[model samples]
Target: MIRFQLEESDREVGRFWIGFLHAFRTIFPGFGQRFLAGIVDHHQQPAPTTIAQLTNELEQKNWELILENSSLISSENWWSGFVEWLQPFKEKHSIVFLEDSGKMMRKAGEELIHGISPKLRIALTASEIWWPRWFSEEFPGENCTELWHKLRVANNIKDFSSEIILPKRNLLTSLQNQLRREDQELLIQQIRSMINWLQDQGEWLEAVRLMQNNKDFEQAGEILQDKVEDWSSSGADPLEVLFWLKELPGVLLTSKPVLCLSAAQAANKLGFNFQVSYFISAAENNLYALQHFSRNDKLWREMVLDESGTTVQGILAQITQIRIGENHETEF
Candidate 1:
């Protein structure tokens, strides 16, 4: 008997096996209906005599018997009877035994395992079947990568799209408490990897959002700085930059004069007169905060004497000359 059982929750999977077997039987009717009869008769009667008669009727037909959900049989006597009947035919014919629970198999006794050769025993999990179908050759098993892949596939996220952001965030929130500790750690690693990949692809705003989700504000700030710098040079959509900047924590935004300056630039570009005035004031306030720090402080020294020799004071003076209605151009 080639005995194996699929993981729990696979109620319809038996039908697939049954259909395949029925097709095979249809292809070769000369093999007779004994195998199918034995399966049906075993289920209907489940008596020792029924098994014996089925065994005797085989007469070296070279057939295999498949028992689906055999563990579901509640009678210990039936199990014993089945085992006894199989002793003589063990080497002559193949019997496939299916069970849902290994605990039930052990509770029944060692006889089930001993009666069936250890080499023929197989256990299958739901993930083994389900994950492979959707992911094909790229399935990475049950890990953070698998979860991320599933999320990406489920949301059809080919690239960074605003439509999928909320759905993906909600899905992650739902899974936070449901996943195992190791899986959660794996998910964290996957998120970090995704953030790095987004940054590499120059999807800076998307990378910052992911870092924010991970609560890696420091990294998010660094990436946001890069994004602002890139936008300033590339003349990218400034409103988009302003929107993401507003999403950042106020403390983080106010701590960096460059961030505040970028917001001011974006507002000015978009012709938001009030916002331009507000962000410019915020930039000057942050610049004032920077000026008060000890000159020896690393942040103070970096802002005052950057590699390009561009100072926050210099940028502040340049921005202050702009009127609300004029097309003001400020450089960092």
Candidate 2:
């Protein structure tokens, strides 16, 4: 006898399987009646003998139905009035149900895992690349995030497997272009998470470029801050930094000065000589309050002078104008 108890969490998988069975009955004449009877009779007794008898009967002829039902069930959503009837066979029939269902069930993984035995859950998840499609269709904002965490633990996956599961870069670019304004942050976070999971150092630069090309400047700034030292110290293409700086939000200059400084340095490296002073002038022009700005004056001075053979004299005039304008408004 399959020693298992139906859990509340398994309700979705249970419903899908039961629905599949309900559909299965309509196609095969006598099989439905016997399947229904087995469920009812086995439930009333709740004993090992009844379960064994039902299992034996089904095991003998069920494989034939399972093979046929495999294709038939994909087109139907027939779970009703037979959930209890199929209770005794849940564990015994789980694999046949999942195997036959294919990607059709990929969208229902959260519910599906609950209805199966723990061991079966582990087996399905441990098989690499099995859960990614399901996850892509049902995760991040669908309230199935916990299920992803669970599957990761079960499968021994140490990090989020974006490289394995994420759609290609071009697809991501298209999605970004079509995504609504309010959902931009969601896309940013997803891409940011992918960037963090990357193992190859060289790929980080490419990933940053992709984010910039997709116009995810906020995320691009994040990646720049994360890897700016490596790229700068290694003499990577400073034009990449200049490119991001061109698109980056002015508001981020005050809020994230390190990124601003990095962009300025990258621009300076490429002999865009005035970017450091330009950056400071732009920040003062756009930002009224630098109270929360965290970058120190010393770092700002260093970034302004480093290799550019330039000074912050022009930026200082812009800064004085901003302060005078703000003070005049206060007096008014």
Candidate 3:
């Protein structure tokens, strides 16, 4: 005989909500008929002779099927029925225990639960590869994600023990392109544009610094690679830091780096983690803002089309104004 209880906080084995559900489901078929007999056999003190008589006495419940599933339950999936805001029995959980019941358990996991209850059932699993490690500490008994990952690999190998397989996405590449193309006018435009872009991207650069200083490689990679816009399409490279790469505000020109340019020039120094979002319209306008104003919507007009008439300072002011106006508008 085994006692049954449902608890939410307790991570104890054979006492979880899932364990109770499984146990109930397992014993329900035989217990249902016994329950019916127990109800029917309600009478004045009947003969309490055999073990079977005690069984019938214990099984009776005259009321309708009040409690349905109760067998071989697990701790997982107990949260399925839990609703916090509206109180059920207690504020924490609706726990009821069964005393002195025979118990049988299913497998350690619900690997085949899908075949049983497919659509209605949601799987209880922690992420293996990408899950945060704190989850394991939160629920120590819930199978180890690390071990589970290894188990999956081991199972895969056992299924095809002799087979040696290569990855589907197997490719090899080498050789780097060695062309140095520099348009002085475009460079000036890029340098100016980046200096202004830095103003809007100060916090982002700070986040980058934090990552670099702390050696947080992943976050650094993300901040440097995330796209600024979704719709624009252009061939681009990572580590293209087009924003806010300016010298200090009050610094002398001689005290600053040798030169400042039109575009982000920090990519070569930084890893391929940062990227510059280039809008063709913005670039075109920056190149031709003062003299020609180019087309209103062309995204990629050569910025320094007429370098003499289109100075970097003017282009920076126009682009900055356009950007400010854009930011002012609610894009939502």
Q: What is each predicted model's overall lDDT from 0 to 1?
A: 0.48, 0.43, 0.29
User: What global local distance difference test value does model 1 have?
Assistant: 0.48
What would the per-residue lDDT of candidate 2 be over residues 181-252, giving only the tens digit for each residue? Answer: 565555555454444434243566556655654556677777666767666788666655454444444555
Per-model TM-score versus the true fold: 0.44, 0.30, 0.18
What C-alpha RMSD separates each model from the true structure?
Answer: 26.2, 25.0, 27.3
- What TM-score would you give candidate 3 relative to the actual structure? 0.18
Backbone Cα, N, C clashes tallied per candidate: 1, 3, 30
Full candidate order by lDDT, most accurate first:
1, 2, 3
lDDT of 1 by residue, 37-86 (tens): 32211113323443455455556456566655555442444345445656
Candidate 3, residues 135-176, lDDT tens digits: the string is 243335555344334434533111122221211100000000
- The candidate scoring highest on lDDT is 1
The segments of candidate 3 whose C-alpha lies over 4 angstroms from its true place after superposition are: 1-129, 132-134, 145-150, 153-280, 283-332
Candidate closer to the true structure by TM-score (higher is better), 1 or 2: 1
Of candidates 3 and 2, the better by lDDT: 2
